[model samples]
Target: MTIPTDATPSGLGGSEPAVLSFQDLEVQFATDLGEVRAVNGISMEVHPGEVLAVVGESGSGKSVTSMTALGLLPKNARIGGVVRVTEKDVRQLDARRLRQMRGKDVAMVFQEPQTALNPVLTIGDQLVEALQLHGVAYGNAAKRRAADLLAAVGIPEPARRLKQYPHELSGGQRQRVVIAMALSCDPKVIIADEPTTALDVTVQADILDLLRSLKEKLNTGILLITHNMGVVADMADRVAVMYQGDVVEVGSAEQVLVYPQHEYTRRLLDAVPRLGAGRAQLGIAAEAPPIITDEVPALEVKNAVVEYHRLGKPSFRAAEDVSFTVHQGEIVGLVGESGSGKSTMAKCALGILPPTSGTVAVYGEDFNRLKRKDRKALQKRIGVVFQDPAASLNPRVPVGDIIAEPMVIHKVGTKTERQRRVYELLEAVELPRAAFNRFPHELSGGQRQRVSIARALSLDPELLVADEPTSALDVSVQASVLKMFMTLQAEFRFACLFVSHDLAVIDMLAHHVVVMENGRVVEQGLREQVLHEPREEYTKRLLAAAPVPNPEEQRRRREQRHAMLAAFGDKVVEIGDVPHGPEGP
Candidate 1:
């Protein structure tokens, strides 16, 4: 089923030619070991007023191909074949001519807005600079145009936002600012590289809507690079699937996504977590036999309230009166959007933050009331998995040492015994023995996450707090990690508090669900009850906003969501005027 859009081919007039094209493109990077071919001979084109999605996992040459079109490749890289923008060959152009074509003829929207935007400059300064760089506008004219761009992207109070820096905005707002900057020069083509990968579902839906509207209004061609099949289903008119430097499949969005002919494409589709699929269908084991327990729960948080004090203003309540329980062998999912206090709740559970008003108990013992030495001893019974393994793992340490560090800290074993345990943990996580000597930088994202998992389990903790552990991974990798997590939980009978914004993932693995909104739990019950028969309007909104890989279903869901919002007189959620500091909510 295809999600129909109102977009029509009218960008720069219907008489215009293709905005971007690639023919027999080949790219290679010269390295000390050998010459590595990144992109094999491949061909594709993007016309004005259409979105052409390039979908693949990491190392599939998706980004490299798009980078070549922008002339952003390194000097040492060898490029072959033709890359054209509006009939002009980008390869034949010199540095100055290429610079002129970059913002005027083509522009790019990056995956991470924080890195793409300058931290020191105001949004107005950056947007105006982009316009002036292409000789589109300057001075008062540039400011006015910048404000217009911001308003066009659906950001409220465009004029006031110009004075704010990138850090002052939320993740969704930052991304909108990036899109506004891309439109400053009215380029014919926009290359969006994983634009919504790090965003929440509602925010992603809003961004996709804005892009579709822009395509219809301006007729700008879009080259969308992403690995998410749902995104392709929602946005693309045509699809190109890449695998290990080759174009494995190409067709219309409906044809490619629903009736994919290639084996690789089918595997990608199979790896996606469907909302209603049971554990067996998703490659996870059924719930383990209920753990025999006395009266004590594995973990408990009662009337928890966390606050952040301010120097000159009222304190902020991050988590208010939140309460939940994770029984032994149970996985309770905490679901919410960004700034919804999910992380704050996780921190409170981990005892990293002391709640101001309530108690956190582990196996019936109050965590905050324990003595210093007793608290240290209790910590050995708890494990944690952060969102980004690269940030959590020490870069300089070997995988073996990293895994063994927890044991070493708790004085669990000798050097030789710890070394043997490292190899055992590696095998348990399905990693090779050689990985024991590799550094974090030497491994893939999935491998690093596995290593983090192994390290977390090294202490053999009774409870685990996994916060968005699979959010950054590709679909296939995420599936494998989740399956492994389920298997390990079954084997060890350890309780878990899994926090994420992905309802599909939660539906696949969780026994109970807790829905959060603005630092409070709006709903909590068994998964079957909360997900299937949601009682709160906010939970229904979240379920409605989630995009399915089926285009027709997603379109239907979008329409229903819009109608629901209208009925309630509720506006689309936007980044509010919260104070932007180093600390997060």
Candidate 2:
């Protein structure tokens, strides 16, 4: 049975007819496992000039429901009920009509811009093709309109950017191009699926601002599907909370987020790591800080610089004059935007990428001066957990082998002993011993990450390097993983260098924080000093840009971010209107 909700449109869309509506929608897919119901009977609507955010954890039908709007569901999908875009029955639309309505009446901005766009095609070519295919413009006229769209989305050098391929543009730039493509025909409604999930907080803030600006200026309704509550707070006028393929709650952002009536919604919000909520927020009691003993630190970098050499052009300096120390049993968070040298520094610290200058010391031994055999011996004392477990863990390998491979390489124990250790590790990460025989593909994302963590701890290493390990997970899953990681860290007493862009997660897990910008450490100190009382303007701006889960608080933070931008001589993204020029007809 569907739960009762306010259901009525509010805010900018009040009393206006809905641009998109779902009436008792149901979706099911036929799989090898059997017929699985992905979406239950969900009824919702998005009104012109209003933002309706559909938020839930993975597999909760948020994406499935949105996909129905564009008729993008798979052939195996058995869809029921009505999905109306501008009151046109989507289920009844013919192929040609569906294509005609796709970019003209409604469009979609996918989650990953890289996959949404064709890599081989230039940005200009793709945009022009979209315009031409939609019968919006043609030839030189389409090219000019493409440039205008890029500019409208705030990408500088729009004309120059048009000639570059997707790989040439930064992540944020590529997203802007995708948005430009979505707006080529001035669609009445745009469906954005996890639009800012992969972006850094500052870039995420910018993208949200851009979307909000475009929605108000063009009066285009938006259907936003994401698991990010902070994003909902920032963008949504109305909120729809989905759980187990059903809409459990629906109302204004304030009603749903601030005063959630559903138990699931409350749990979801509670899982979100607020910027200032330290370990105590997750029920992890704060322990005394690690003792500063005379023993060598677990890892130390001294004026390190890492550079990537080009064929003939100047070398790209990824990190410069970077220095920090991770003490034994301590977790040091390295925070920065993408390409801000966080990962590069991690690689150098791991000895995967040798620094161009300066020294990296591991347990008081200089990694650069170590002999090959000694280096391998030293490496055996360290472990690593990458960001994407699916890519990092071999698919064909069973969970048992993946965890035991590290011990095997180092010849740590006999076969029986290794299997025993693997079992112990499975229990440590809160995974069943039965998971030992299962492949990585068989596990859920959280389980796969748990496997990764289990493998990292198998070697009993003194230090660990974890790079954005929880970035891809849902809030609830992330909270659980963080709690388990804290428990394991306490048990193992290993020092960790945790790299991530999420300030909230950093605040929750890190004992000390290091802020980086343009490959330099701008600030480094205890978590309280760096987060609560940041001294640098950049740090303040970063904190201000991070969205809180509360709509009221997010609004105030938005204003504070705008003021910070202005104070730093950086103007907020102001996309008032598309300019008419000779480049267009």
Candidate 3:
């Protein structure tokens, strides 16, 4: 079941097929009461040797459009309009042919790799199965190519990963493996959906560079679907801004990213955290709430030491004399890369693993010296939101019950009070009350996270420890969620311990910042100071890796070049002033 191909460009077309084109595409789903038009009249064209970015927020029909192009929708789906590939139409193709086109010609990288890949099967076996099913020569040739593909996607020890299951790999590694699998068949047009959502800023940059280089070398057209405007600036040659199933704006990257005329487009651009951008930059002058410490800090980790003793070698001291305080009403950001022991320190703080030698105090109560019952109460005070909401949530439980469980455990309030609080908390996180009856599976990743936050806040704790809360969300959605947390913090006067690898997010949220490396506090200061002038080497490295809207910098560069041409046209090689641009060069 091959999806259809559109007509190729005038010259330099693929002999394989006319990449992919959408003409008046409409996708509708029948509901219990009425018809839902998910994708409405979207017309797009993608040629070889180009990257066409489809940018929009969730429910904006970007995913529906791309997923429908490969015949991946439900059986009852109603699809109209022309989706042509090669000389055939994708919408007209049967199930078998559509399956063939999906991996071979049009490869798609879904948002979540944990659920996308089979849990039982090893990555190598999955790759082998894909190769065989898609008409690849088995034996040595298939094995060799699989290894090459893994290495190409920046996965180290490629051969070992082949034998490893999806769970064995980190979230970032799993995403890279999916990208590797997508590229295995030499797809004419690759659709990457939030490809870097799970990756660190540095890794994201590497992946983007890899995609650009590969696309150029293979002359493949890339249909990148993401809500991250920063990515659009970096990789997209052209873009189509979609909202509510309609194309609101379409133009070259320079036109759409820099000179965006649409309000929605402008908002989308502003949503991404700019490296040098501040609230003052947007004319919204605000300050972080004052830190509230009751006798002792809200959460005080004094001389926290955690060590990992590896077999047949010297023991590793992960956290060496780590000490920090997250006071009430203050958001403290912990920024670092993977394996820097950021999560390890978080686990120590949560009492998931007791520290080797440290004093942890909650509300002036020494938690490290408490009994099990006392510790449980202490744990309730420090609410934690994990990285992956789906994996953290129980699939069988309803969302409302999930949020209510905390209150029930602590017996903080009566049953009626707890239920009432649940709805209020849900509203606080911007989730509908009806979501209470729904399972985690029914919600989007972002929605599930909102539920997670609502559940954390249900306990009415004075402190919230969110570990990479917005790491996997779209930029605009992330901004909304970030702002929501800030507002909630102000309203409730609760402290927040925001753990993230992204500096841009830390810049926006944290009043005070703490940079960690190998579980030690490398740098600690006020947020404004840390972001502007990072003193430690590790802190500077992390700052250097922050992702900004690449277009803003690129646009500034182009404008400077144009100004140079205008100011000293024809007459010269005069390389005068570069003219101070909008921050990053």
Worst 10 residues of 3 by lDDT: 576-585
TM-score of each model, paired residue for residue? 0.88, 0.90, 0.87
Instruction: Give the lDDT ranking, best first.
Output: 2, 1, 3
Best by TM-score: 2
| lDDT of model 2 at position 72 | 88
TM-score of 2: 0.90
> Compared with the true structure, what per-residue lDDT tens digits does model 3 show for residues 1-585?
111232222343434444788888999989675898888887887778778888887778888888877888887689998987645688789989998887778898878889889999999988877776776647666766777778777777989889999987877788778887887776778888888776766556556766776676777788898877777887887788899889988877778888898999988887777665644433234766666655556778889888877789898787888888988788888877666677887787677877778776667777567899998978888788998898899999999889999888887788888889988988877778888889998787778888887887777778788888886676677777777777678778888788887777777777888877767788899887888987775665555545456666754543444354456442211111111111111
Q: Which stretches of candidate 2 lie over 4 Å from their true place?
A: 1-11, 288-292, 365-377, 388-460, 579-585
lDDT of 3 at 39: 85
The deviation in Å at residue 233 for candidate 1 is 1.2
Q: What local distance difference test score does each model get?
A: 0.83, 0.86, 0.76
Which whole-number lDDT from 0 to 100 does residue 244 have in model 3? 88
